[model samples]
Target: MKFLIVFVALFALALAAPSDKDTVIVEQNSEVLPDGYTANLKLSDGTDIESSGKLEKAGTDEEALEVQGKYTYADPEGKVHTINYRAGVDGFQPQGEDIPVAPVA
Candidate 1:
């Protein structure tokens, strides 16, 4: 009976463990661009969100850059919405404006 209880407890513990495939890891790195160059973030779902302005150094620091971009995503009803983000020395802050999405050609 003790052996059966131990096996059942181990089975329950194994069931409660998190699988590696269910985790997502994000790595932050700086992307360099030429002058007047703009970057676009293309999502895996075919959403092409463009940057509003060029990225520049937030200050004299070499660690981070200021990113000004808009992110667009589609809802279950097929309605697209845009959320603008700005990254500075204080970190990323999302703007409240939601722009309508344009159809991707």
Candidate 2:
């Protein structure tokens, strides 16, 4: 009888534990320009430019970006470009709406 009681208690505890597989994480990145803000500019032919930002989130797959910064991009040829961007919670929903919860036999 004691053994049976212990087994049931352990089973209940296991069920109460949170499942890591059900959790999700999200990340984002952005960049800012030195100037106040700039508009679109044409880049010189055969020139390439790149910029980067950072983001970090946990607890849910959804990411909510309350604000975003402005950034500028300039090509090697000295062509200038500017852009303003913002982000928010996006692409966050359960893969399946009707996941079955099976009873522990």
Best candidate, TM-score-wise? 1
- The per-residue C-alpha lDDT of model 1 at residue 56 equals 52
- What lDDT would each prediction earn against the true structure? 0.46, 0.31
Predicted candidate 1 versus true structure: per-residue lDDT over 1-89, tens digit per residue:
22322433353334324443342222222233442234444434434455433435534455344446665655557687776767556
Residue 54 displacement in candidate 1 (angstroms): 6.0
TM per prediction: 0.42, 0.25
Error of 1 at 68 (Å): 0.2
Q: Candidate 2, 19: how far from true, in Å?
A: 46
**For model 2, how does the per-residue alpha-carbon lDDT over 1-105 read when each residue is reduced to its tens digit?**
223224333532342233423322122222233321212211223112222222335234642222333334333455654444343344212222233446799
| Model 1: number of backbone collisions | 0
By summed lDDT, the worst window of 10 consecutive residues in model 1 runs over: 23-32
